[model samples]
Target: VESISVKKIETVEEFKDLKIQKSEKGRGISLTLPPDIAICEECLKDLRYKNKKKYYMYPFVACAVCGPRYTTVNALPYDRERSTMIEFPLCNEDKTSCVKEYKDFNNRRFHAQTFACAVCGPQYQLYDRSKNIIETNSIKEILEITARRINSGEIAAVKGMGGVHLICLAEDDKVLEELRNRKKERKYKPFAIMTPKLAILENLVIFSEKERELLTSFRRPIVILGKKKGSNDGILSNQVAPGLSSIGVMLPYAGIHYLLFDFIGQKSLIYTSGNVSNLPMGIRNEMIFEQLKGLADFFLLHNRTIFQRCDDSVLRVHNDKVKLIRRSRGYVPEYLPLPFEVEISGALATGPELNVTGAVLRRNRVFPTQHIGHIKSLETFNFLKNALFNIKNLLQIEDKEIEFIACDLHPSFYTTTYAKELAEKYGINYFPIQHHFAHVLGLM
Candidate 1:
């Protein structure tokens, strides 16, 4: 017998499906961030069950409640029109079914914009370094091939919601060594690992209930969990965390990620940004092909165009609240209201070189763009410009705002240079505060 529990409470919101509406800057409804979600149980069921036509053997299958959002979204209101999914229209049969389910208020897929099935969803393929199609149009076959290659200690550049990730069997030293050598990764920095389930995570790390919730939270940030006593022997490679007492772990967030864990039958894979050090991670197929051709043995390429390249969000629980270490992908371009209204209006701050996030103050509220990566390369500088432009539009701050641009006073820092350029373009004043002074004032 199937029954549903219903609760009604008096509120200002009469919600249907996840209705994302385009709101003006500083006044738009900040919905639950698209980042704080993981694979739901029903989708999991669809993956492992016998329903071959619906979700079985499909990698990109997603319902209304899950799958790619911030990465695929090109504009606000978060509709398919504003996303990279505009290219792949649903087939006629799938479109009919989608419309029926969309109009049905009780269905889980009601108005699910990212909804797709085996018959009409995005497809996956496996390719060699030369772009030779190793496997085509078969997620199961791709999984099988990826599993074999990973088990044999080869690196796979697997695509996901936001961007491509470099994955290898976590326990393989030879593979880790190869990855380190190829990427020129430092010896001490640990690579994050993706496990299949919480049970395996429990075995590997000493965690609290909050940490457990965080581990399994929809945001699915990489939680830095302390190592359980005697847990690292043979189960993990020493290279994963050279001298660290904690391990960064996450579970599968997408269907393809879950399928990979199922087929590999391994608990952990060394998951890292699929880019060279000091550069942005790759998102487009051509970008990956060009940037990671020599390093990756097999490429799990997909046709989906990632509208923006967002690295997986990274953070750790501390003192009961999660502290952000690297906020991208899952947590970019979110607006926050000041506890009390600020006296200032229309101010902009270009943050420091490392852990870069720019902020604009509009109508006494602060809206920070998601991490723009290190402001070093020419490409990154352009990204910073785009971020500033996008956030300005989101916050509805006109370019003519007479306020000044604030940035670090570091003589040779690229951010400072960018600030000067912005000042010149906008005919605004440039405020260059000392980096150390900013740090001290920030703490105060």
Candidate 2:
């Protein structure tokens, strides 16, 4: 559906691999689900290479093949205006160079949706808990300052494409304990650690080819890796994962994370959601500071508005088969084909409470929203609605077809109530499918 044309060749020997018919043909509008791809080598080189012009210290630098997608996007055609990046317009050099490269098929940035440079893209600003600006002049210096704070055991809230993360040097046991206490997270819940690359983990954990692939893939989910046999694990504080032999580890998926790695050196960082326990991940910097109170010593944030809050996806390979733990980021806003084709078109399915998820059936595909936290609170419920529409608008399924609204049979549930209201308003049939029946059919 995405590709334009096909050509027949006389023979394999006659085929020239790199031939292009350059003409005055129209460029197609790019339609992408835009998962948060791991920053490509080119962008990483630009961050490290001083001669890369405006791309140096540009935390959000990206090309068409990589960078943020679902987190920054609002609605699509996948245009920049539909993304959080719409707020940052291109600078003169970046705009002119982008146009020149975009017109040339040979350029890597040709038709790149998220292409950006330092002068024309979002810049990271470090602020205190009161939101006072600490550093804004240069990313190199900003990261250096943030690194020093972390080394001194000060917690910093680093904002990413998805949401804000409360981060600190993971080597300090006191810092890990403080972060866990501040977040009020479960004692049994392990904190995921973020690092620069995969090479650092070679001595830390046992890695299979599949595990390495998942760790380095564009989705960039935290893969739970088992500890190496009889290997000492005193370097990273035990408070990170407590008694668990395995630890959740991830590589830098966004440009900002990679830049932070440069200054932070080889040390691990406690990267947990920037919100108190039982609440959604904080998006806006002001709201994050309010929620975190004085826990975050410095706020490393940018101007990008997260369309929807997405937690880092977590996966574990059990018996060499991938087991999804927390499904968000990288894997969302994409469709899952049902076992049997869903007959109804544009049907809404309101999932059950806790570990909650929602979906919309458009054509033969079911577009499930990313894990929308528990709908127990008003805030989480609002997040559910926002995520539902975010996926709907992106899928271009605005007019809800008058098919049945599927909800759990339980009465008085928030999700069920919302489904009833939507069904009534749309004059559609509502099915109160039993939660057990749903369990049998795997609908839940």
lDDT of each: 0.76, 0.78
Q: What TM-scores do the predictions have?
A: 0.89, 0.90
Model 2 per-residue lDDT tens digits across residues 1-444 = 345898986765764445333333222212256567778988888777778767777888888798878888777566776677778765546444655665556778776767777766777787887778884566778888988888899998888878888889877888877776666654658888886667777867788999998998888898999866543355588787778899888888877887787787887787887877567878887788888765687788888777778888989998889888888888886676677655565778888888888887776777788888877788888888888877767766546553878888889889999999998888888888888888888643
lDDT for each residue of candidate 1 in 17-135, tens digit (9 for 90 to 100): 65535544343323333542466888788888864566786777777887777667655655666677777665557444655665566778766666677766788888899988884
TM-score of 2: 0.90
Best by TM-score: 2
List residue ranges in candidate 2 displaced over 4 A: 1-5, 9-31, 94-96, 229-232, 400-402
Q: Which ten residues in a row have the lowest lDDT in candidate 1?
A: 24-33
